[model samples]
Target chain A: MGVFTIAKTITGNLFSRPPTSRYPAEPAKRFDLTRGHLAFEPENCRVCRVCMLRCPTQAIVVDREKRTWECDHFRCITCGNCVELCPTDALHLEPAYRSPEADRPGKEFHEIPAPPPKAEAGGETAEA
Target chain B: MAYMKRSPWIIHYDGSSCNGCDIEVLACLTPLYDVERFGIINTGNPKHADIFVVTGSVNEQNREVIRNIYEQMPQPKVVAALGICACSGGVFRECYNVMGGMDKVIPVDVYVPGCPVRPEQIIDGVVKALGVLEEKRARMKAGAPAEVPA
Candidate 1:
């Protein structure tokens, strides 16, 4: 009885598909909440510097005056601290990770364009 | 590129790590992520390895151990820094004993950034290191320097 059970198990193992996924040939599995890398959208940014202040690793740098935001990929821990703290929802954790690099690609910089001046009520508008 | 005739063997070392990245590194060897299909074997001795996988941040004490392991690997070798800690010291950068990333002690061929790197990312880093290994082999074949100055 034991011999027969062992033989059946061996047959099943021989015919079954391997558990390993072909990672390089195929894309790795990703989840909706996977924290692979940090992303910043400059357009939605208010340059409040909230993420910069709360980041544990100090990987984020926000220049309010220049409207520039930067994150050092190498230094970042992908902990989602800045993503949650972003008041304007400008920061997010992307599902696709930053690819490995041969050398350090310094800090990723984004220059947020200054918002256009609001028009005053019953005032002459300046035409470009 | 065609020069590689054998599978690349790797040796893993843990510096002053929290063991988070090390667990992920071991996960790469499990059936779910099985790195063996790529002809990557995890070896114990540094002399028998072609790739060095290091986890954690360098500190005052383990710096020498990291250097010794790096120096033991043969020529045409590649080093893959497997986590944010190994890449740039992670949260321990401010620690008094921490000396930053693996680059502080040895040349790093690939940098995979994650708090505790996922197994998929580790595979990606290893694959990237293979490319670097090929280039280094080519340089060695041509009688040129294997590593460029930092």
Candidate 2:
């Protein structure tokens, strides 16, 4: 009785469709909330340094004076802290993941445009 | 040479890590990722492997072991550092024992950076490693240096 049951199970599995997905041929399904890679739009950033301060790994660096934002891809754990803390909605998590590179990768820096000079009523605008 | 392109056996090793990346590395062997679909075979012995898949960062304790594994693998081999830990020591970089990335110990051919690293990324890294393997083979045939100078 036991042998017959085992045989049935083995045959059942032999003919069943493989659970594996065809990954390269077809892109893998990813969730909207899936944390894969981080993207930054410097133009939208205010250079508040929030993302840099909130990053647990200290992978992000913000230069307010220079209006620059930098993140080390290798050091970043993709923890999403920076993305959540970004005030300007400049940082976001992309569903697509980082691909392998032949050469060792490095940190990327983005330059944000300096804020426009503040307008003064009936007066000249403040120099940036 | 023909078999090298079709079937690239891999030897996986963990240096210093929390094992998050290690689990994801194993996931590639599962049916969901099924790295074997590309004729990849996960092997235990370094002598039989064409690719080295290392998870985690290099630490003082495991430096020798990592080097030994790299040396054991036959020529025309590629190394894929899987995950942020393996690529650059991740959060452990400041640790006294941490020694940075796989590049600190061995020459890394491919770098796949992430926290634990997704199984798909590992598969992608391996596929990229395969391309590097082919290039190395061609270079060896041409009698050029086996590796590009830094």
Best by lDDT: 1
Q: Name the candidate that leads on DockQ.
A: 2
**Which regions of candidate 1 fall more than 4 Å away from where they truly are?**
A118-128, B1-6
**iRMSD of all candidate structures:** 1.0, 0.9
Per-residue alpha-carbon lDDT of candidate 1 for residues A1-128, written as tens digits (9 for 90 to 100) = 99999999999999998788877678989999998898888877766677888888989887866778899998998899887777668889989988888787657999988765552121221111
Q: Residue A110 CA error for candidate 1 (Å)?
A: 0.2
Best by TM-score: 1
lDDT of 1 at B20: 96
* Model 1: per-residue Cα lDDT over B23-134, one tens digit each: 9889899999988877889999999999999999999999999999999889989999988889999899999999999999999989988888889888888888988888
The DockQ-based CAPRI class assigned to model 2 is: medium
Error of 1 at A109 (Å): 0.9
- The deviation in Å at residue A105 for candidate 2 is 2.8
The DockQ for candidate 1, computed on C-alphas, is 0.67
Off by over 4 Å in 2: A2-16, A119-128, B1-4
RMSD of each: 5.4, 4.5
Error of 2 at A79 (Å): 0.5
